[model samples]
Target: MTKEISFIDLGLSEEILNALNDLGFTKPSPIQAECIPLLLEGNDVLGMAQTGSGKTAAFSIPFLMNIDVNLKAPQLLVLAPTRELAIQVADACAEYSKYVKGVKVLALYGGQRYDVQLRALKQGPQIVVGTPGRLLDHLNRKTLDLSNLKGLVLDEADEMLRMGFIDDVESIMATIPEEHQTALFSATMPAPIRRITKRFMHNPKEVQIKGTKQTAPDIDQSYWLVRGMRKNEAIVRFLEAEDFDAAIIFVRTKTATLEVAEVLEKHGYSCAALNGDMTQQLREQTLDRLRNGRLDILIATDVAARGLDVERISLVINYDITLDSESYVHRIGRTGRAGRAGRAILFVDSRERRLLKNIEQTIKKPIPEVALPSKELLEKRRLAKFTQQVQQQLESADLEQYQTLLEQIQAESGTDLETIATALLRLAQRDRPLILPPDPVFKPAREYRDRDGRNGERRLRGDNRESPKRRERRDVGEMDMYRIEIGKENGVEVRHIVGAIANEADISSRYIGNIKLYETYSTVELPKGMPKDILKHFERVRVLNQPMKMSLVAGKSSEGKRGRKSNQPESDDKGFAKKRGRPTAPKF
Candidate 1:
């Protein structure tokens, strides 16, 4: 066998090594071992590795070691595809450069206030990490400077392409000095990404690490179909019934991390939220607590939980399903480490079956569908836990004084000892009862048969037998027609529109009515009198990287048809309506 290479073998700086040692990373991963030496030598490196393969450290250590603390005008720029990943990269870089003083790192992304970023930019940080769009916006506003840049790294290049930010990336790269070093990392080298490497990189060294497709065999994976109850309620019920030492609940957004953690805390769970907004010290302290068994549940976003290893984490709950299979694997991989058996439970909504299917295909195994924990099981577990607590108190505590007081009270009230004990038990459990209320009965949506005579049980679509034109002409009873700005030209399908609306709006597929596709845009039927806030929210919901700028069609007549002919475009032989200008109606 080949000798194992440590971080020292890669010639990283003492400061970086010290930080890595503190972070519990002794040996470099395959990618890190191969790329760090080249990066330190000022080579343009193109790396191909799967997610969670230590790509951040492969580029970060060398980059941190090369930073010039004297010139704090963005010596290095790292571009990520999303805000979460941007913050995550900045956090990792900050951690690696902790010992290397005077190296300021700032994360710039959307959703954060402009004044906050403006103030940070004014500080002249040596390292800048941001999404392509937000970075470009700052560049346009002249708030960011990269004149003294030494290198630029693109994290998740392929994801940037998929999210329609390749142009912005190219623009940002153009603004950087041509002689600076460039490093690009991606899971797959697609055509566009390869073109970028050719245009931007100079004789880049290619490092490809072939990853083994394997999940822990000790992990028992399953999913719960989210139907009748809210996800927070479901999580509380599951915790009450299931036996687990500790768990990490994964959510999608930073806001959701706080929201879910708050709900669990209200239910008396010893949990905390981990997200991008937390300080480095706070994040490390939170993880330390988790490692030592002080925290039982951790509500976190995907980026916040990167590189998280805890032996006590016996379970992982996907409170919100992940967008990709690789993330699903990584999330579940948090458990079942060190030859320990673990459990992974995914919560699947009705509209997220396609995402579930994608994960199944990737893992090459079907995650069995399960119902939520029943009331009987929850009550049984609660009673057992209460009894165990009482037993522990009886065995460990000195209750003689309490027993004498109870006897005196019994004598004064002329009641038996049994009655007094029962009354005290009632008082003790007044806030939290030993029995749970019955859950609402879940009614699954109706499944329609496809044209192939197969039951499309989990598909979020209407009848497959009807043509688009026929379905479009059907009377949309109690539903309103709205046009969304994405169609055949953007490679949007009926299911894409349906899934986007249903998943984003948290509405049932049955409530979404007929859909008509055109070249540039499409019209979807939705329930009438939808909240304005929901309509405004849909304006930002993306389908196939295109935003659904949804707007209500003007002037609906009694026959469920557009009152004005201008709003309805005539259909051709292929059932695709001809392109038209913007609708005359006002936006929601």
Candidate 2:
């Protein structure tokens, strides 16, 4: 049996080793250990690994290290399949280059200023990482120089082949100096990629890493069911309560990383932005600050955050669903590394649940479902964290100096011990209001009406729904009462209940009377003695699929006329059964 070697023994600079230490990485991943040495010798290489197998770093590190910064032109180039993937590949290069000095990494794709890319190109990046079309566009315009190219990397080669980039890749490869080292990495080797690799280079080293596409095992995974409209706010609330040392929030695009980060910052989070648009220097600074705790949350596109590992990152949040299982594993792998336990919380909407199932099957484990943090729970969590901060600082305070001041304050105010402590705690929380704004009124929860056509849950009814300006609750005058299993937000219609009773109970619509909708359940009026048989069938009748158990509304209604009512069931937490919504835009 042979022993595995470590990354430090692989001839990386001490700085790279140190950065790896800070990133909580010790040994090179199999592909990295295998591919790096060969590629460093300036040989063309063919790599076969699954998605998320650390392919980006395998090719990027070699390409980045071999570049000539003195040339003041692109010495190495990487072509990615999509705009997001391009940005991600560029970000990976920039991250790996942080310890490698003077290596400028630039990303070019659609949706940004072309002139900006031109300017950066003119400024002389040591490496250009871009999508095929954009890279070719620059090559044609003569804005990008391939004269000094020393390396070329085709990342996700099969994906590019699938996207019809094989022809473009061939053309771009033709433009680069034939002497340049070529590296192609893909999860699958299609006929075209194999053909491309065969034609593009001399004998190439091939290293296939096992489980490269497999999800990291250290991450603790869970999910929450949420509606489309509630997702953003729910995510914000989760961030509020979560005890993240430093979190990386993955979105889909360079643009989304910025936009979402902007929203988080506006909400008073200590956050920083990372994307392909950032210069290599700025990208390093942002990462450095995060490592040093100058930043608490990092918002980034997956491309922008590739090859990024922060030891302090105890949490990984997938704000938007990635399109593939490979990307899903990659995003959440940012946390729970290096013998540390990590938590990955995925916010899933109705449409994205299918992705969740797909991930579960791929991972071969069932990820548990969790509920959104309730408003009250979020407040309690915030307060507890705030108090802990104060306690930690209080234990470290200079007692002699502050104690003297405190004595004087006690003497002057004649303050009791409890009074003084209360005052101090109050002062600590004054600026930091633990009380969050009231959560929006959610509709009542439904767990299906029973056989008797009654809801199993009680609706948390009235005085909660947001109105133009909430009106004062009127005292109740009871009318003959009836039951509705559906509550507000269930698409409950007075007419639906009226029609159900009018038809099933053989009761007139006029006698059906007034209706009220609550958080979990609704109530309506019914005429007395509508027929025992009719009532029996009526109890089993579903109004909007909710049981129509005849009973007086729980809350008092206008004019005390409580005919008769019985308990149906308490409503579920509001909004549990709202109709499914559309697919959400992946957090880029």
Candidate 3:
């Protein structure tokens, strides 16, 4: 079909229709159109669509329209498994509520002050979205008054079941007025979840959508197997290493979203942060800038970014691997919208091998592993970007002031025009390094000899060089140098370093270089010309309060260093499930 479908045909209000038009929603997905009309008639919907299938709007529009913003008590309630999901559902409600006056959308989750949520609750929001734990807490404390609740939505119900929050969800539903309508959306209706639907929902209209479907098929997906130590640096390196008109980098947490957005903005990324904490006004303003092409890289948590169908998002970077197949599809869905071609990248950890299997199985396609952008490619991309910028300046710039300076510099310095232009080029490429910088954390070159006539292969001073029967198994192939700041002085052991890096940066202990602990620093062997951003962050990253500044030493050192090749876990995990049944940690 040439078109997906439109929400207007579903009979949304003129105000909502205008808002949708403003948001550029050309048509509703099959799920939205089918569910919206039924819900507006106050039907209890049992929506079963693949993740990223526009289910948020299916429930949100009807929920928003029914709320009497004038009556402040919570009228509609949605329970999510994770803090992030809770926040995101609330955000979608907020967006839809923009036209509906006086009704406030509040998100309740932990990891922050409860007083803040309580204060907002006292202000009388028309709708409440919350994780089960926090919602239960508020319910027990009497901060959340759901006596007037007319609608209850159970989002990611399968995940809540997996996380053992079904009891809370059932309890919450029980507490709500039995006469009210209820809608439950789950990727799969497991036995436990189905029980709730049977018990609570009255003559619910079921919408079941299946398949290990990639949500936005128009989007092209790629990934960089970056060493975990320096993820932010890797991000920065890759930004210079590629060309994107606009991108939205997805991180799992509000802290990460804000932190990465800040770093990108600082380094000239035209980026902004979208999270639950930002005001409704500021959120709208940021989206406005993004739509107008004034911003790139809107770093966001999944919850804060729901219904963010920005056609301008040319790239989607999964800074963290999503917890579920559905979220993976949903986050990437933000791009490639409206039949536009989009690009998406997922950052995976080698330890989560199980996740790779799950994702591949879930998507029913093999997502090939790709190497990080090489230093040479980064330089090329940077140079090309720099040239394009220069051309733009040449076309639009006011030249009189620069022309006088060019003429004066030519006379005084006696420099050729090429030389002057080269100087300008250098200036442009200075802040954003066109080349990857060498890291200090990796091991020294093994083939090379120390000034003392000892080969870099020789062990440290305390080691018994002549000792036989070494228990440690050395790889048969060549080894490379990789540096780290952790050492004996830092109370670090080989195993600790291995475990931490494996978990945090996705670096396998097998590929790790020779670790020589020093009083102030230590080094190991790693593959050459490493992605500088990942390397730099690893160099300064703290392993037990002492920063493990991981980097590749310039030259090769030992055996077993052939670069580079690219999981665990239980569960058939089949039968169409949502990404991250619970909220925060689904993304690795």
Best by lDDT: 1
Model 3 agreement with the true structure over 1-588: per-residue lDDT tens digits:
223456666767887776664443546766777788788898899988755566777888887777786798999888877654665576567666667778777877665356546656777888888877778888899888888888988887887777777888888887888789888998887899879988998999887766454534466776555453457767886776656778888886666776797778778878888887789999999999999988877988776788897888878888877544566777888877776778888887543333454566666667776656666787777777777987898897698899899999999999999999878767767777665554323221112123121121122231221223432432423333565766675555565565454445453344444555666556554433455445555765445434576755434322223433211122232221111111111011
- Lowest-lDDT window of 10 residues in candidate 2? 451-460
lDDT of 2 by residue, 1-588 (tens): 214877777787776665555433455667778888888887788888766556776787767666676778888888877665665676556656768777777877754446556756776888888877778888899898899888888887887877666787899999888787888888788788889878997898887765524746667899876532244456687887787788988776565676678778878889987877799999999999999999989988766787998898989888876645566787888887776779899876443554676577557688897777776997787788887887887799576898888888999999887899788877777545677665543332222222111111111121122122322322122333456566665555555565555444322343344566776677664433333434455665554434566554333222224323333334533422221111211110
lDDT of 3: 0.67
Between the candidate structures 1 and 3, which one is better when assessed by lDDT? 1
Per-residue accuracy of model 1 over 156-234 as CA lDDT, tens digit each: 8998887778898999999988779888999898999999999999999999986648654568999997765567667
TM-score of each: 0.50, 0.47, 0.48
lDDT score for residue 391 of model 2: 82
Angstrom error at residue 15, model 1: 2.6
Please list the C-alpha lDDT of all candidates, in the order they appear.
Answer: 0.76, 0.67, 0.67
